[model samples]
Target: MEFTTALFYVFAAILILAATQVITARNPVHSALFLVLAFFTASGIWMLLKAEFLAIVLVLVYVGAVMVLFLFVVMMLDIDLDKLRAGFWSHFPLALTVGVVVVLEMSAVLWRGFLTVGRQIHGDSGNIGDTKNLGLVIFTHYQLAFEVAAAILLLAIVAAVALTLRRRKDSKYVDPAQAVKVQSKDRVRIVKMKAESDRVTLAATEKQGN
Candidate 1:
């Protein structure tokens, strides 16, 4: 086997192991670390494929920013492992169904690509690592598909925000509409009190006279 092929297998093996550990690890922090490893390995695989832009982006965006945030959140939060695992069995059926559907969809796409392996649809064959060429191809040929992906990403973002958002009794949040409509009278109350006599002055005057 060629050295590149061997290197590819090595990266793939490490990626698979890291991904497995991400789900299997007992500690959340350890899981986050493994996920970071998986991202790095995947980026290495992308680099081997000559997609340097994607590899760099995977490392910078996922490994550098997203994974660091995940690590920080996992380390900082006081999470109950038992409570988190309690619903795992209950949700397994739904999760499994979703996983199968995703796998089938991915398989379909990969099958189509495999069937067209010999055909080179893009005219520019030399610019493999050029971001400009990639952009041109995406914008010109796959514009609709690109727009659809962007819409899907937007929907996913909204869904994630909606799912994670909860109103906690212990948490305090202000309503922008209410804040904008607030009046000074509602927030502040003025009270008038008569000044008390200075008994120390009276005592000093009495002492001087005595």
Candidate 2:
């Protein structure tokens, strides 16, 4: 076979192995590391496919930003591995069935494309700097779709924030109207009470004792 085919197979193998490890690793940190490896291999495959922009974005956006955040969250959480694994066997049958169905679906989809050869992406020529034209095409033709996606992403962000900010018994909330009306005098009180001398108080206490 050709060198390109061999390279593809190597990257594909790495991706598959990493993905499997991501699912099967006992430690969440290990699983996250495996997922990063899988992303790397998938980016390599994208590079091989001449989707340079996509490969770079996958490495930068997913690996650099998203995966780092995910790893941080996983590492920060106090996960009880035993508790996590307790229901594994009970859930295994359904999980296995779903896994099998997914595998079959993926295999069916990929088997057809796996045999296909290369073509120009977005009708652009096989040039190195086609990303600019591709972006122009997307922004021009799919402007409405892009805006819709942005709106959906904004909605998701709002939803997540609302959920995370759910009021608990101990949660302190400030009234904006009260906050607006507050003044320095309202916040700070000047008490005008007479102070008793420590010497006089002591003398009074001694007299009382006598």
Report the number of the highest-lDDT candidate: 1
Q: List the residue pairs that clash in candidate 2.
A: none
By summed lDDT, the worst window of 10 consecutive residues in model 2 runs over 120-129
lDDT of 1 by residue, 1-210 (tens): 999999999999999999889888999999999999999999889888888888889999999999889988988899999999999999999999999999999999999999987775463864545677788888988999999999999999999999987888999988899999999999999997755566777878899999
Per-residue lDDT tens digits of candidate 2, residues 1-210?
Answer: 999899999999999999999999999999999999999999999888877888999999999999999999998989999999999999999999999999999998888677664644454564543587667767987889999999999999999998898767887888799999999998999987656787789889999999
After superposition, candidate 2 runs with Cα above 4 Å error: 114-121, 126-129, 162-210
Global lDDT scores for all candidate models: 0.89, 0.88
Residue 5 of model 2, lDDT score: 98
- Candidate 1: deviation at residue 10, Å? 1.0
The parts of candidate 1 lying over 4 Å away from their true place are 121-123, 126-128, 138-210
